[model samples]
Target chain A: MKLSLGPLLYFWERDVVQSFYQSISKSPVDIVYLGEAVCSKRRNLKLDDWLIIADMLDAAGKEVVLTSLALFEAESELGLLKRICGNGRYPVEANDMAAVSLLEDQSPFIVGPHINTYNPSTLALLSESGARRWVMPVELGGETLKQLQQARPDNIETEVFVYGRLPLAFSARCYTARAQNLPKDHCQFCCASYPDGLLLKTRDARSFLTLNGIQTQSASIYNLIYQVPELVSLGVDVLRISPQSEGTLETIDAFYHAMHSEVNGNRKPIEDWQIVDYEFCNGYWYGQEGMLWKRTDEYKNLESALNR
Target chain B: MAITPVGMKRITPELVCPAGSLPALKSAVENGADCVYIGFRDGTNARNFPGLNFSTDEARQAVDYAHDANAKLFLALNTYPKPDQWQAGVRAIDLAAQLKVDALIVADPGLMRYASQNYPELRLHLSVQGSATNHLALDYYKRHFNIQRAVLPRVLSLSQVRRVALEAPVEIEVFGFGSLCIMVEGRCALSSYVTGKSPNASGVCSPAEAVRWEKQGDHLCSRLNGVLIDEFSEHEQAGYPTLCKGRYRVNDSVYYALEEPTSLNVLEILPELMQIGVSAIKVEGRQRSPAYVAGVTRTLRSAIDACINNPEEYQVQPSWMRDLDKVAEGQCHTLGAYHRPWQ
Candidate 1:
């Protein structure tokens, strides 16, 4: 399976983002998705900059895909959609159907996770219309993946969201703007301040969810570091790692080790790869409680006993 | 346009009912529901309350009983799965496929995909929890997943819904009665931020456990996860402490923070919705009792009949529904979202 870097869902200084991707160009990831997947107000890189960066990544021997904004709230957003899909330079990930309809029947594209591609018939329909690969919706597990893969049309690659904070929902109203006490239309890009996102904790401070612009994401970062074998067995062709602000290099390296182990299946756990938080959950990957980490020795030892 | 007995058939608006319990399901079906929708007791469905939804055996039997009486049963697998809940969600789909349900109302695209893959023959209704707010998202689900019916978000006007229905591929279901969700369904994160569970992720919204009502001297203070949303005096009625419905202090005085404590009643607007090609009218009360179920269903069923029997006699008035609030949560009612003046 190939390691694909999903789009950056956060905003940062142009130089900071540039430096981060510059370092990533040297990483082991084979596919890199670029573009702002959140609030369109974050213009860290314009069309020209993104094109130049895409060219740079391609020169570095990586497959580059451009992403469209998740929520298209304005008419100008529609204009941007046409520009992105019509760029005609690289594969586009259709976050919404407007983008899909633009690319469908005309070009080969990757079906983004949020498009709701359920059932073999729908997959077949989109595949016939020229979807080369599809990232399974984020919340789906291995059993469903296996079923979809079995029924998936020929030559369409299956991808899964392997790591990062899960994008749970998007809306017309910006929670980030609301937090800053501004109406969505007149708000002056306040989401730019929070590098990761504005984390809203319960009064109990349980580290609940992250509010980014118009998107609501899971508070716990999803790390599928341990489920490499299961993903491989399910015939997943690409693993999309959604970009994060911190520990990204570590994430790439850990996924490297895990994917290597998955590919070869004859190795101990990667010792050099430091897990920032094993609080690191693979529960969603393993078909367990999403917040539960299964690799904890207590649980692993119990598994060993159950096997015995 | 004039109606006559010469017309081939009079279209009766569908009386869609909720089934939080088996008894409620039977009551709704017996009373007047042409179709009933239920969910598994787990977080697989959006209404994941303690005593609501059905167990596995109960779901199987409920479908059987609904079918025997010539009514359809729609199973709601509406909550997005936590990575761990995926397998269990698919298990629910497999069971539904085996049972041959009339439809599966799905909220999550992932869940929609799982059901579509596992059971190609089963009908698919897009749950409002899918939050397909516009024609684009609506058509995508309709075209790709072959969603046979769509429970639209409570954020559109009757005209916008008409335009969408014209462009959308399947049936359109609108909420005719229930608590008015001011915010878009499936996209709300307010409750989850203040609590560990989110409605989109955990099949709950502003969970009951987080709500606490206290007597603070002369006022009744309702707090949700410790946020003082409302303080009601003895003269006023206290409502459910949903994040959207709570009263909060904007400047100095306390007010209805997000929305006034009013439940949704679109009975007056039912003809307007039906004229706009609304296929099904939903009455939302998954946590309601069987008596309430019987009463609401019977009333809506008769209302649908009344409209068909005489279009000139069809009029929507608040007086049409007198005691619905006595049994309603939050103790008030309005035509939420469907009516623009709700703002």
Candidate 2:
């Protein structure tokens, strides 16, 4: 399986974003997704800036894709979407149907995870519209991915989100602004201070969610390094790693090594893996509550014991 | 039901209402609903609550009753079905086709294709679950399946709604009143994150099975799957536990970080909606009772009529607002995204 870097979902300083991509050009990720996929108000990087980074990554032998905004509520956003679709050098990852419609009949595009692709017919229809690859929705489980794999059209690749905080929802109201008692219009770009998003805890002090500008994400890091073998068995073409403020390169390296180990058929023990030190959850892969963590080995051992 | 003449020729906005049961359907039709939308008794629709929705026999009765009163009955096959339950959605579409329901409100593109191909004559209205906030997205469906109408998601402001209505290929529908969804429908997964059930897949949010209530001293606490949603004081009202509307700790403060539990009411902006060429106004409460549906539908029906009769001299009656406030969630209402500052 190939490793791909998802679009940066957080807002950062222009220099920080540029330097991050500069380092990413030398990384092991085979594909790089660039552009703002979260809020349109985040203007630290424009289309021109993304294209310059795309050119650098292209020179570094990396395939680059421009991702559109997940939600568009203004004409300016749609105008930006049109420019991204006509970027002329890279394929656009259509996060919403507006991007899909704009990219249709023009070139092969990617259907981003935000677009609903639960069933086979939706996959087929997107394929018919010249979709080259489709990312699985973050909340869908491995079982659904397996079924979709069986029914996917020819030449359409399947990509699954394998790492980073899962983006759970988007809203018109900005929770980052609301947290500071500010309205969305006059948010003053306060979310810029939170490079990894502000953590929101339940009243009981349990970390429940992370409040990005207009997006809510899982507080737990969704790591599936142990499930790489299962993902390979399911015929997943690419594994997507969402970029974070810190230690994303290390996470990418861990996934790269994990993918190589699975390819060599010499699955190493969990202790030998250079995994990041973070609370991990794979419950969505196991079809349980997304916040719950279930070990694959536990289920395997239970099955073996039952058989014996 | 009368179309007042705007600048040129413009169709009067229809008052589309919701019905969880046959009585609600009848009440909606009798109270001046131009159309009534419902779902099956199973998970084919968004409001998959216990003892709610309609069986086929009841659905047949609903169709007859709505048609007799010159109101259309629509079936909502809105949820995205996974492979395990894909056949259930197809079966629901087949049933809608067989019943000759006036329209089938759909969200899934795959299911939209199925309904469009198998039953070419069946009218299609894109459900709010589809989350088409712009005209380009609406055009995609209109170009592919020839959808007659598309319900705009609640994410768009009034000006954005007008921009879409000006360029959209199909008729437009906007939610006028109901419990508000802070996030875009069909795109949210916060419910599944906590309860393992989602409106997209299971057609329910905060499913009843995952909900637990406990009283601690004088405070009443409501929990969903062992997660404390809120703690209500002795005199405070404890609203239904939805993840978005619940109080949570953001930074150092604990409050309704996403939104407070309040219903969305657009009675104050009926003229603006009609002026934007919106074809329909929807009152959203399929899980509510018949009396709730009747009261909301009656007020909205009169409001729409009054707005049409004299677009230049129309005012939202104080009594209309009072009637709606009686059934509003938390006994409070906001204009939601329609008012730009609410964002």
Candidate 3:
């Protein structure tokens, strides 16, 4: 299975973003999705700047796809969307219906995970509209993906978000701004301070969510490294690894090695990829609570016996 | 307030209300709702509560009762059903068609396609859960599924709503009053992240089964799937443990880091909504009581009528606001995303 780097969902300094992609250009990921999928006000990277990075990634033997904003409340955002769709070079991953409406009947495009492609009929409808690949919606389980894979169109590719903090929700209200007692219009670019997003914990001190500007993400990173073999067996074409502030390259390396080892018939120890300190969850893949960490069948018996 | 003396004006917007049960449906229609929308008794719609929503028999009676009152009955098949439940959604669409409901409010593109292709005559209204925040998105739904109307999620400002209303190919509906969804509908998975059930797939948010309430001495604690949502002191009235509305510690401070528990009340903006060409005003509560439905419907109905009678001289009455506040989620209201500052 091919590895794709999902779009960066946080706001970062322009230099930080540029250097991050510069390093990503040499990463093991075969496809890269870049652009602001979160807030339009995050203008640290201009359209031209992103185009330059897109060109750089393309030159480095990696296919690049541009992502549109997931939530657009203004007509000004549509102007930017039109430019991205009409870039005439790279494939645009349509995040919202507006982008899909603009990109349809033009060229092959990708339906982003935010577009809510659930069943076969929606997939078929999008496939007819020139969608070449569609990312599975984030919260859906592997069973849903398997069922969709069975009914997937002949020309469509399926991508699953295998690693990252799951983006749980988007709002007009910017939680990052709200956290600082600032209105969204004058948020003061405070989101750049925490490149990984501000952590939100419940009253009882359990880390529950991450406030990334207008997007709310799961505090626990959703890691499906153990499910790579199952995803491959299910015929998923791409595994998307979202970019975090740190250890993204390491995460990519882990997935690359895991996929290769599974092919060699010698599964790697899961402990090898436990480099990140954040809690891991794969419950969404198992059709359970997304925050709950369910061990793989290989270790389930051992863990359950220990619990007993 | 005195009734306006001006002649009845053009395009008095439709007042669409929610009906979770038969009594609520009757209450909505009797209270002067132009259209009453209800979900099926399964995971076919967003409000898939335990006893809420209509069974097939209840739906049939609902259709008759609504039509008898000259109010439209819309069946909400808005949830994005997975492949396993796809057949169930298809059956619900067929059921809506068989009952001769006025329209089918749908969210899933696949289900919309099925409704459009199979039941060509059924009028389709895109649910807010469809998450069409812009006119172009609404146009896509209009072109592909031939949707007659699209409900705008409560994420757009007043100007954005005007732009959409001005340019949208289909009729536009905006929520006027009820519980506020801080996040865009259909796109949100926060509830599912914690509870494994989301509005898109499971047709509920922070489902009640996962909710736990405990009295810890002087404070009442509310938890969703064992995740602490909020804790209320003895003097404070506790709200439902909706994930987004709960207080959380952000940046070393405890507050409503996302949004406070509040209802979105657009009563003050009735004239502006009417002027902006919003075809309908929707009240957002299906899990509420029949009395709440009746009170809210009556309040909004009068508010809309008052605005229509004299768009220039109309004002939001104190009594209407009071009546709506009683049934509101937090007993307080804000213009939500419609007002610029609220965003």
lDDT of each: 0.74, 0.90, 0.90
Ranking by DockQ: 3, 2, 1
In DockQ, how does model 1 score against the reference complex?
0.09
Per-residue error at B54 for model 2, in Å? Answer: 1.2
Residue B84 lDDT (model 2): 85
**Superposition TM-score, candidate 2 onto the true structure:** 0.96
Find the number of clashing residue pairs for candidate 1: 8
Runs with alpha carbons beyond 4 Å of true place in candidate 2:
A269-277, A296-308, B1-10
lDDT of 1 by residue, B1-343 (tens): 1111111223455788999999999999998899999989988887899978898899889999999999999888887665446677888888888888899898766677667766778889889887665556666666656777888877666666766666556777888887777666765555654444666667887788878888888988877666666677899877777765655433233444245777788778766776776778898888888998988887788778778777668975454577566656666677655554342
TM-scores for the candidates = 0.68, 0.96, 0.96
Q: DockQ scores for all the models shown?
A: 0.09, 0.84, 0.86
Worst 10 residues of 1 chain B by lDDT: B1-10
- Where is model 3 more than 4 Å wrong at Cα? A270-276, A297-308, B1-10
lDDT of 2 by residue, B1-343 (tens): 1122333345698889999999999889989999999999999999999999999999998998888888999999999999888899999999999888999999999999999999989999999999899989988998899898989889889888988888788888899999999899989999998988999989999888998889999999999999889999998988888888889998899999999889999988888888887888999999999999999999998899888889889998999999999999888899988887888
For candidate 3, lDDT tens digit of each residue in B174-243?
A: 9998999989999999888989999999999999999999989989999999999999998899999998
Q: Tell me the TM-score of chain B in each candidate.
A: 0.93, 0.97, 0.96
Candidate No. with top DockQ: 3
* Residue A24 CA displacement from its true place in model 2, Å: 1.4
